[model samples]
Target chain A: MLMNDKVPLIREKALWMRRTAFTMVHRAQLGHPGGDFSAMDILATLYFGVLNFDAKRPDWPDRDRFVMSKGHATGALYSALCAAGYFPEDWLQTYMQPKSLLNGHPNRNYLPGVETNTGPLGHGFPVATGIAIAGQLTGATYRTFVLTGDGEQQEGSNWEAAMVAGHRKLSHLTLIIDRNRLQQGAGTEETSGLDPLDDKYRAFGFDVVEVDGHDHAALLAVLGAAPASKPRCVIANTTKGKGVSFMENVASWHHGVPNAAQYDQAMKELV
Target chain B: MATVTPTAAGLQDCRNAWVATLEQLAEADPRIVAVVNDSVGSSKLNSFQKKFADRLINVGIAEQVMVGVGAGLANGGRIPFVSAASCFITGRALEQVKADLAYANFNVKLVGQSSGVAYGELGATHHSIEDFAWLRPLTNLTVIVPADAWETAEAVKWAAQHDGPVYLRLSRMPVPDLDIPNRTFRPGKAEVVREGSDIAIIACGTTVHLAADAAEVLQAEGIHARVLNFSTINPLDEAALHRAAATGAIVTVEEASIRGGLGGAVAEFTSANQPVPVERVGFPGFLPTGSTDWLFQEYGLSPEGIAAAAHRALKRKA
Candidate 1:
């Protein structure tokens, strides 16, 4: 009954996601493990504790939709979907294989629960806005959510989408920026500089909600809230590679695969 | 010889037919919606904004979001016709057109208005000569270039009911309706506008009627030419191409880049499958400052120019 009760379940899901995602990356030797770990808690909290979805009916019209704008974090996305029961657990074994449905990016046609295909940054927000607009037009109760990386905000398309969501007053839309600070080569502050991110969303007419992205209870409180008068933007402050101490805050892990001992160390540290 | 621009009076701008048909379809299907990048007047959807105000989404000169939003709208069980100027929609929002609409395989209609050199004297940046080449490679997206007002209406209806991603490349130029009676709308099929065996002229969009005119000129010279209106660029009616190739010579024409429009597709299909003498007539590249008629005349898009190209193909056949 307590909101805090959901935290433990979310934490368990997050741990499994981190471990499983790291394993998938370890086996494949090609994954954005840092991003996967950073975004795992937010994805876990949404799938396990906050969002409303039915694994059996991924195309259910009224179901809430989540678009992963930072699509390279397929380690996080695929693991969460599998745990959410959208597909079998063994599906993760074939991740990025010869003809796997689990591609490097989220493809809606190949996999269920993937709202759209996105390998390119700055795509999901606009698509999610369209989905929200559709719901608003039909007077449907479904809400739409999109997750983007902090550095991904440098994409002009996200700003373009932000302008629309703000102007249309898309009440049923929520945008979560995974504020991991670090990008591929450097921190976001040193890269494109999104320090005024909260203010930026506010200027775009969003109801800004800043939270600790890894804090399950706080994430639940904001993400689980009902639709607002304006489109909501949750700036979830998170550390890149949160679980593994070695990978944490390291930009090289943006697309780094783990070695044998490193994998073992990460697995132990995740729990 | 100077040719009449499709935008000349007493003819029809295909955008009117497109918007009219879209409004008619939207009336019956509540799922039908229009998403524009602040192109209400240019896309001829001002009345659509008036009648179905809520359904018309004006994204304000943002082509990328306009297209991505169409995919999202389609995901929400609504059929969206994302309309914008041909140059911006195809050029600016190209990645979205490929990833969101085509690669994702969303059921969205992307209507491109004022295609070709419709924006005459506005410089090469506004001309969508390379759109066919750019979009043709995206095999998942069906590309349709209607010849006139009637075909524009039919293509709009067809795109709405087709249940997949379709790129309706339209022109603001005024064009007379094709003389073909009982011409039904087929997605990937070519319509035989005129019959001839000496040489075949395959054209699409604003050039179909001109090809028909060239047929008459060839007829006066006792050289019968077949004119094929190739409305669909991707999924080329190969059966038709084979029949066109059977004519021994082929002259392909369009208001697009010679490298990758209807001409390019026909040449690609013919050279590999059936070798024949092929003459491709279209823009060379970007152009100098000129009106549509002057540009058409300069770039060999007129009836006389097309007829000359047909003769060149025929001579090569000889």
Candidate 2:
């Protein structure tokens, strides 16, 4: 059983991840706020609870690999990395600044935690497959997890990777779909319905599981469960803009940074 | 140089040379392996698959997965030569090549078969003329175009031994060998096939033999021309180019698009360092369907056409 003492601490860590996400986006004045906020809790659970990585040995071959397939939500990843002590927390303030480590996209060249340079849709899955395949070859127990956005799933490449993952029987790899219903322009159903997403993944030969994305207990339980045989896929059903009162489930916040008043309100709500 | 035997025999495609050399390399070294996008027969890698069954991983027509698997194999301490049709390998998996091979700095060797107009009958849809233009901008990726079977063999051996990202443009067209018997292939160096001071004919891949034949014609006409076999496109031998520029006139030729092929590379070198009368010869724009030979001749990538360009460049030279 998971230590009960760690449960309260995970909530604190997740709240910190949320605050860091808001602060970085507010500082950069440019970020995918909706996706970042929706996925923050999940990222926190992985970094704090599941992932086995040390800031000192960032490139350790045996360490568990994490790829942010929804690379536009790099602000969330940067904040998580900082909270994990990979870098200074103050580094979040330099988001998108000239010569700063934070770019519009996560560059593996500049950042220690980023495994691949991703910004284009459907890019990270294949790369994560590569990392996992490497582990299989080396007989290492390291696991690779990739998180992709609901809109980004429309890219044909993601499906292509999904098919390969199943065909290769990559039980060491896990694909987490941040199934937030809303996209940049409209709700995913209104834009392009992905209602049968769970079935689609199951048909693709993955062992599929559905869970509430925001609930820490459910996310931890589902994410920690090892695959029985085939590669596992967790459909993290989520709201587009989660946590903040007015922004939740809104599509406009996909890339819209909160104004000063909204920022204060968001901070107050988080507190 | 290989002299064609008068005996009636079927010509061997250079891709066969690529696979044969790959198998030979694999037998000698356990690390050498082949990666493909379900293109085992297309890339002439069936012999390799037969010999090393488990090593040939057919990624099932997914170019992006093919590249990623290559990077993964490289990460697993295997020297993977990822083979695929040039159009899909370079076009579909461009970002993967940039990230996994170039950015991640893996030792994955990308082998792009049937480059240029080799897929002539398949129409412009199958052509890979823009491969050089797409790959030249990226750092840590060496691009090489071998002129004939001999060069292709030498290039494959060199790529297997050399540790970094390399792209070998293995063509399907047949040509007489341009290298001396048992000559070692050097990375990032140019080979001066024929010597002349009036004009320098710089070419690569199928065009290297064309450039040599063009120099032969120029010699008969009392217009001497130097033929430079530019096998390595990137990390170009600048000193040799500067020496060629001193000859007053240089004509660059290739089967790729004129905008970013051999001509563009030479022009970029000369414009900044030593400007001279340089004539660029390549596919000028979009082309229609035909056989490889017909397309090459139609686009003036032939010996006679190169000779004419050299003569014109000589006339334009100060």
Candidate 3:
């Protein structure tokens, strides 16, 4: 767990990550900024305070693995990876550009910190479950973590993986759902209600926990806990766009890029 | 009506051979693990599970998770063999196969058991005639349909040693051992069963034996049809196709659909490279309920049907 003296610095880093995510999406003129902002704090806390990894040796055998199941939020992941020194900060300038390693979705072949290629929803969760299974078989102490969007849970594959993970009792695996409530076309409630989400995970045999997604200290505390006998599911309640006022909780902002004025105002507000 | 009898003396089930080879490979390598979807009995992995209890991962009927788990195991430096029924593994988890294995280029072997109408009486839902069509287009995937027990064992051994994704299609149907013992299985290479000049009969999996029988029948009639067994489908042996084209006529056969199985691959290769008189032999649509033998005969997948197709191709030769 992070010490009290370092908690403020981690919060400050999370704020910086939000700014970088916004800039990447704004420059690309394309990206899921809403989910990016929503999951920024969780990503920052996992990379900085929780995950046991080495940026220099990304493929370290015993290192903890992190998979971003909501892969549309590449901006947030790229910012976190850069902040963790996985790549030079200058790489951020070429996000989504032609010949840039930074694609709209993370490609594990191109990126070092990326554990696997994920774009299609409900895929990373199962892959993470398999990784956790491997960790168990090898008796390795390393853990596996995956982050999924609230809307992405509608995919049936997630349930398939959830059932197996629960049945296998992969205690080393942690699944974090960025519950922003809004999806692409409408709110998750209007589309397909996932209320009682914590209960649903608990039924799937997970040790469920809910947290304020933006609170860095809370995220660190919850994510840093040791594994129990069952898989852990962290339901991070969040606003769709955490730092931007106009985009926050707005359903249309799920993929809506801010215009010049909106972008300017958003940047000023973040500062 | 003229009735045709299978000429091969002894027949062996490829599934048994696959399991035998899998056990040998697993015993040799500790990194080898079997990931199944509660298909241990169907995949002939009961012995493997019993022997390597800790290594067998049965995900209990979840095909998507089974494939994903295989990919994850591969990432953790374990060679995962994902075994399941072909219909569910390929049809239900097509996206996982595409993303987790092929596109990601994971070191996993997908063992699709009971492929190509092997479960004929169970109905069309259980038939896996579309596996070739489904898997052929995916890049970085080596698609193989071994003809018999020997080929299946060799292919399984090759897949375990190979460092990339491979789909090994095994059948519940018993097939004659066409391959010589200790022959090395190479991907993208076709084995010539017999050489001739009138017309070439190219086939794979269940139809390879039919092609061989057809070649014998044609020889008695003085047709002298060439026989080419194509175990590997995706990285197709174009060189062999060109050699077959020299015969001026070709008849392609498979136990799968004519759309994208061995027949489709042969047509695609021949039409573009060498314009030859070609006749394709295989099932066209969803198979009706029947015994495996009845379905094979009904769909013109028999030896007599293949020989007739060869006769038609010989007529078109100019």
By DockQ rank, best first, the candidates go: 1, 3, 2
Which segments of model 2 are wrong by more than 4 Å?
A1-5, B1-12, B24-32, B72-78, B103-106, B161-163, B181-184
Question: Where is model 3 more than 4 Å wrong at Cα?
Answer: B1-9, B179-182
Best by TM-score: 1
Lowest lDDT sum, 10 consecutive residues, model 1 chain A, at A262-271
Candidate 1 lDDT over residue span B121-217, tens digit each: 8879888899999999995899999999999999999999998999999988788888998878888999999999999999999999899999999
Tens-place lDDT digits, model 3, residues A1-271 = 3355557777888888888888878888898888999999899889888899999999898999999999999989999999998999889999989989999888887888998878999899989998999999999999999999999999988999999999889999999999989999898998989988999999999999999998887888899988999999999999999889998988777788878898899989997
For B1-318, candidate 3 gives per-residue lDDT tens digits of: 111233346877778889999899999998899999999988889999899999999999889889998888987889999999899999999999998889888899999988878777787788888888999999999999899888888899889989999999888787887844456677889988888988999999978988999989999998888898899998999899999999999999988888988888888888898989889898887988887889889878888999999989988999
Worst 10 residues of 3 chain B by lDDT: B1-10
Judged by TM-score relative to the true structure, which candidate is superior, 1 or 2?
1
How far out, in Å, is residue B289 in model 2? 2.9
Ranking by lDDT: 1, 3, 2
Clashing pairs in 1: B6-B173, B6-B174, B7-B174
Candidate order by TM-score, decreasing, is: 1, 3, 2
Q: How many residue pairs clash in each candidate?
A: 3, 0, 0
Cα lDDT of model 2 by residue, B1-318, tens digit: 111223234444788789888988999987777888889988888889999886777768899878877776665567889999898899999988987788767789999988888778777778889888889878989999998788888899899988899999978777777745556688899988888888888998888888888888888989888889899998788998998999999999988998987789899999999998889888877787677778888878988999888878888888
Model 1 clashing-pair count:
3
lDDT of each: 0.92, 0.84, 0.89
**Distance (Å) between predicted and true CA of A230, model 3?**
1.3
lDDT of 2 at B94: 94
lDDT of 1 by residue, A143-176 (tens): 8989999999999999999999999999999999
